[model samples]
Target: MQRGFFVSGVASTMAENRLDNITHNLANVNSTGYKASRSSFKTVLADSHLAGNQKQTSSASYLSMGSQYIDTSAGSIRQTGNALDFAIVADGYFQVQQANGNIALTRAGNFSRDGEGNLITQSGFPVLDDGGSPITLPDGEVSGTNDGMIYVNNQPVVQLGLVTLINKNDIQQAAGTLITTPESNTESAVGTVVVEHGALESSNVNAVLAMTEMVATLRAYESTMKVVEQYNQLASQLNSDVGKIQG
Candidate 1:
């Protein structure tokens, strides 16, 4: 697998993976609370250990995709003027209960009240309160304070469920805009989060940058494929010449 063709094969696959990620970022450029993914690279040796292998074979080195992480940077907050919409100005996530009774974190706060007066997300998941219970609001001019306290007509209702992650890497994005982390990675962030009423957080993906990277990745992939193709042709020609000489 240390041959030039084999290395080019791996390179092509890696480029395709990068292109996929870039495509996803571009697609979600307008999505609410969307975080873009970033890819990393690492060098390895075909002798099996670049980190600890004492072998001095520089020609056998290989490149690989190291890791992928969700960029947790905050996006622009836009005022929607809708009372149900909310935005977290700082480091925190909103908690919502899933259909299977599991909890997930999200930054998308484009919420609305159900017919039963329960505050739910756009996906219909009931939003949790500071006490880890569903937030049931009474009708008539709903509002929230900067500290996530909800009040209706100047009467207190409940506080939004705000939590923070201990390790940024612990957050894993799920289907749609929802994300989850292990229970050990999360803690109640009651006063740590600053919420804005009548606003929503846009995606952090930069469209122009992503598009440029997409083109670059595509070109790199094509170049690797050409190398692989050229290698195959030369290999075939060499085999044919060797057989003719033997005959």
Candidate 2:
């Protein structure tokens, strides 16, 4: 196979991955507290044995690994006029008790009360209180202060728990939520987690930007395919000419 064909093919594949990321972002533009993900690419040198020229003037196209990580950039806070809808006032996440008792970080604050009167995320994960316990409000609606204080029926009950990740990079995007395991120096709940009532955070994805990127990536992929086709045609023509002369 011609080296150019292989290089062009790789380029086309990278563009395809980029397009997928853009498309997914556009689809989730309206999702509340959604974070836009950006795809990253890395280049790996071709094996020495596959080197066409010792001078290394020729290079294989850069290989792209699927999105390195989702950008957890903060989204804008929008007023929802609902008391249960809360937004973090600062750089923190609402501590939710996940299924297996693991802690998960999420920006989704569309909270509601369950049968047990526990404040929970839309997915039913119980919201953590200051003492690393679930915040439950039985009598009436629960409200919180900017300093992580929670009150039920106008009576102070438990404070909200705000968790911090020791190594933010260790966290991975799982089903659009940030999942992390316990790490060193990582405290379960700190006193600094603030909750804002009656507001919801908007997705950080820029619809216009994501749409533009999607189109650009598709065009780039088409161009790469064109290059591969042209290279293959030239090779075929050269082989046919040589055969005619030899005959």
Candidate 3:
């Protein structure tokens, strides 16, 4: 009888966590270069038979293992027609120097030059070059090629620094559209990533799908609550019946 209530409690907790994740995804549905996250679960069997020599008997339970973001999927690319706007055509990331001097990776190519003529992201982070140094562009008509080659006044200036992660799990959100991974797990993506100037990458989140998930999760949570309530009533009745028999 108690095992039934335990299962219902676990279910309720899991549903709450799932709802939080869905809500977060919906909020970032329109964010540029945003990635959606999902929760993962696992089951643990507490049966005595499975435990062999365990002293206590317990029932099976579900566990919320945690969550991870979907990073490999590419979002839709749209033409912005802005000279500084850029988008990656394949698997790669742009390297940028954060305000704290730490390096981070991002798919957002929407860039602009700062007052010092240094190429930077919309958030004012300096864009890096192949040498891991901030790129300083000369004042002129600037253009970028699919190969990440930057040109000023028809003269080739510097190529954008692009890289890839050996393991996506090593990455963590640093700021708006910016992610950072362990430096040891990164490698040069010279040929893997193609850059498109005058374009931007949209968020990968699907609004319709997220809404559907939210509805389903809410229903599941309600169902679990009902189960919990039923178990509580059954427990109360059982206690009352036992007292009557004693009397």
Candidate 4:
């Protein structure tokens, strides 16, 4: 009976975690270049000693291992007709130089030129070029090719620095849409990814799916609470009966 209550309590915790992840994903359904997260659970087992010093193996409980944000899938591409807007059509990421001079990766291609003619992301992070340097463009009609070549005044200036990670799970989310990974995990993706100029990528979250998941998780949590409450009532009644007998 005690083990049943323990199982329900652990289940309730996992349900709460799942609900949180679903809510977060729903909130970012409209964010640019956003990826949805998923909560994972695992079952734990332990050995119990029964009568006569006999060992029995039984299912212990469930454990919540937290969530993982998936970034491999590409979001839907939308054309904004903006000269600086860009989108990746393949498995790759745009390189950006953070304020502290650390390199970060992102899928957001909504870019603009700063006062110094340096290309930057929406958050003002300088966009890197093929040579791992900030791209400084000349003032003119700006255009980017599918091959990531930046052209100004119909003249080729520099190529965009696009890369792919050996293991995407090693990457962690930074501020906004930026992602950071160890320098050793990155490699130059020269010809693997195709860039679409004059376009942007929408968030990969699905609202209907997230909402359904949230509802289910809430229901499961409520059920667990009921189990815990019933266990408490039974425990109280047994204690009262034992006291009356002793008296």
Candidate 4 stretches with Cα past 4 Å from truth are 51-53, 60-67, 245-247
Q: Give candidate 3 regions above 4 Å deviation.
A: 48-63, 236-247
The predicted structure with the larger lDDT, 1 or 2, is 1
Local accuracy of candidate 1 as per-residue lDDT tens digits, 80-141: 98888899997889999988888999899999999999999889999999888999998899
TM-score list, all predictions: 0.92, 0.82, 0.86, 0.89
- State the weakest 10-residue window (summed lDDT) of model 2: 47-56
Q: Residue 96's C-alpha lDDT in candidate 3? A: 96
Given candidate 4, what's the lDDT at residue 32?
77
Each model's number of backbone clashes?
0, 1, 0, 0
Tell me, what's the RMSD of every candidate? 3.2, 3.3, 2.9, 2.3
lDDT of 3 by residue, 1-247 (tens): 7667877887898899889888987888777777667777877664434356656655565664455555557899999998888898868899999888999988888889988899998888899998899999989998888989889998999989999889987778767778888899899987668898899888888899889999999999999999999999999999999999999
| Deviation (Å) of 24 in candidate 4 | 1.5
Worst 10 residues of 4 by lDDT: 58-67
Model 4, 1-247: lDDT tens digits are: 8677777778888887788878877887887787667766665764455789676756454564555656568889999999999899868889999999999999899999999999999899999997899999989999889989989988999999999889978877788788899989989886778999999999888788788888888988999999999999999999999999999
Where does candidate 1 clash, by residue pair? none
Q: C-alpha displacement of 166 in model 1, angstroms?
A: 0.4
Residues 39-149 of candidate 2 have per-residue lDDT tens digits of: 777777663243564554444445756455666677888888786788876567767788888777777788898887788887788888756678877777667677767
